[model samples]
Target: MKIAVVGAGLGGLSFGACAARDGHEVILIDKNDEPGGVMALAREGGFSFEQGPLILTDLREDEAVGGFLASLGIHLETVRDDRGLSTPDFDLIPPEEYEGPDWRKRRLEELFPAEKKGIREYYRFYDALMEIRFLSGEKKGLLNQLRLLRAFLTVKPYENMTCRRFTEKLFSDEKLRLVFNGILADFCADADEVQCFTLPFVNTETAFDKRIPTEKKGKLYYPSYRYIVGGCQKLPEALCAYILEHNGRFLSRTVAEKVLVEAGRAVGVRLEDGREIRADMVVGCGSARDFFTELVGEEYLDGNYRRILRDFRPMEAVFMLHLGVDFDPSAFQKQSLCYYYGSYDLHGAVEKLRSGVYHRGSDGYLIYFPDRHAPAFAPPGCHCVTIYTVCPDRLREGDWESRKELFADELIRLAEEHLPGLSEHIVAKKIVTAEDYRRLTHMKKSSFGGAVPIWKQRNPPYLTPVKDLIFVGAQSESGGGVPIVLLGAVEAYEKAIRANRAEGKGPAAGPV
Candidate 1:
């Protein structure tokens, strides 16, 4: 069957590659000159920077992304990170900082010396809750939910509450509350908004069950994360090469204007240039909103799908400040990723962000000193640093264009607060606003992917409403992250192929 994958991002490229290998003629199209959507990379002044998705998590052990890449003859080096929480004053720290079974206990002791016992019990309870879910997978039905309930009753019934409420119950000190609630910031959500069922998985999954090695000072995992040799662009480039090698064609700088629907099934896409390419299936590697509302047209969508697109808010857009600095690596602290939260009010921060406002001091900030992790990112004496914060795509009740510089200055100011003289070391800098992201990738509001990864919305079962027109990417069930997008592409193509074959269709009838 001939398949047309619109938007040659990781998801689209992955689908094209797999479909071509599965004996389908595939055409992967993107408006950009290259693939890789958000995984795109930029280089300047002897420094290379990833445009998006800096960290790679190895979720499932067996089909780990590293193994998948190896299967494709793409080798990647891994860097283990040892990261933890530090107080606003940078004095009080987590127990993971010290080491021992009592590390969490000790850390809690330092934060809430009065409520040390409660903290320890809380950790144990959270761990147990995570173990049950990991062991039981996502409960599917009333029976499975009953099983989960039974397990919770037997182990930790307190898991039923929200993390914010639970933390309040566990500790009285606001600082301790901040430390505990700060963990939710990693998910770009607040403790009250984030599901408690996800806390354990996130905690263990992100921390990788390893203490921050005193030598490394960040979280460590068995399979380390290595930047793609040249940059993240290499991944998409390699995947595109693989697809072409397998007889798949890619159409770059081409936009799919609309999904060509007939007889209640999508048969092809009409390009903005007025060219029509027919296909047995169309897989959209774009945002849910764009795919449903724009390409397919809201008139064709059902209420539930439209509501999901309408009511379902996207994750926050990020304000990224990429800097090329002239500095010695040894001159600065050796930290890969450093998160700073000005206040413990994470929920309030998220609420403000949802409404397209920046939270005061609560702006989610991440400082990436790539030279500390991968020297290849910069020259011998220079360093590359990126300061990122979650912000709404559009400002509330004002023109974001007019306020873009102010936003950028605010980020720089925050960076200055953290790294003194950081501005002086900057040789080059670029700011990526939500508008820039939207213009570049066609993502709605330049939103980051996978804001919500609940159990019900987890994988292939989360298909779009349109018949031949399928959806992938962070907005789809697979959720964001490189590995998930890759997996989503493969799964979507597989489904398309099976459906096409069942219909006895051949290469889709259309102009090449």
Candidate 2:
């Protein structure tokens, strides 16, 4: 069981390919010579682009990541979300076709037609508070947790509310409360501080296909949003080629640098050239307070988790730009993922992006167009596009290495008001500031998306008190994606193959 797994990211190549397909003897460390931490990649002239998480949704109805990449035989190519809807008072709002849930309640009654009875009483109070909080805390089994203890006291009135005061108390519509606060703006918190049971997974296909089940194990499906025709660096090189076809061990530019504790457990890793392997556990995949206060030395933590990794608070980060353009944003019908408001004052531009400063007259932008759903990420007629906008990871109005190209030229002058000669269709460019995501994802405030202190304050948040390290990043939980961090690295390799069958240690792989 020689695990290791430091940070090849996409939750350390999905927990080093499910703990080396569970015979365990994996490796996968990374400071990045290659690996999808932030599911990254960014070439230049011949195109490529997607420097992180660009809507690759094929989890195929929770089999999770196309049935975990067809159980690692691996199959990449996917593409959906056919464009339209460019906004700032429309450019093309005539797109609707992925019909499910009465075509998403007739596209939210055709985009808030005076809140059609407050959009059917807001999806019947968000499907009865997600069926009493998943029939009392996520459908229990194994003797139904004592018959679901009265559906966990009817989930205490939808976990005491806040999806910005329950969607602004069910509607008065400021463009549907800034389109539901831009679907929780990469969730760096706010929507009255998240937690209305995390706003019914904020439109994951209208929160599990417009629920109508109190039984049948709290049914939920959600899968339509695809694009992985090339970038997403072929998903961590297909989980590092299924952990090197199961023999595992693929270090790459090493640099783990610590975590080799002894009597107090987690026995491996210590590689900034000094090299040491050891291991029965030590997994991390990066930034759970940067390897517990810089690679395992918070003196084995436990002053209430070293004051929760020293008063954690990082949630705001994006500022990408990418571009490789000539033109082809689905030829202007646009929308290979679009959300541009320009100003509705999304919570006062998230309180002026915590003073890292980017007031594009009140910040907003999340355009993508990976050549509009993958024309192999651009070449013939060009287009990579990308673009992003959340902020504040620092740059107190100056040094993001000399003003990240003037904040990518003021977000390309607000993405040239919906690409009208978008700075004469450049041939190539790249930006990614917020101190280049805290120097390419060590993520202090480079946040990107995940960790708003487990919003509603820790439903499940433990980022290393050192039980053999552990934390699969995006600051470990709160719905970071790439199929929720590859379903949290296959549930931490099914709790490390159930603690190696309780130390007898062998034959246990259940959970393909």
Q: Pick the candidate with the highest TM-score.
A: 1
Please give the lDDT score at residue 481 for candidate 2: 68
Residues 7-89, candidate 2, lDDT per residue (tens digit)?
78787787778777756678887776777767777667788777777765544534467877777667776754432223454
Task: Give lDDT per model, in order.
Answer: 0.67, 0.66
RMSD of each: 5.3, 20.3
Candidate 1 lands at a TM-score of: 0.84
Model 1 Cα shift for residue 374 (angstroms): 4.0
lDDT of candidate 1 vs native? 0.67
Alpha-carbon runs more than 4 Å astray in model 1: 59-63, 90-105, 129-156, 186-188, 205-230, 360-362, 453-462, 498-512
lDDT of 1 at 282: 82
Inter-residue clash pairs, candidate 2: 59-65, 85-92, 164-191
Q: What's the TM-score of each model vs. the native?
A: 0.84, 0.33
Off by over 4 Å in 2: 1-113, 123-127, 138-174, 187-270, 287-316, 319-341, 344-362, 365-400, 404-433, 443-447, 450-471, 475-478, 481-494, 497-499, 506-512
Give candidate 1's error at residue 129 in angstroms: 4.5
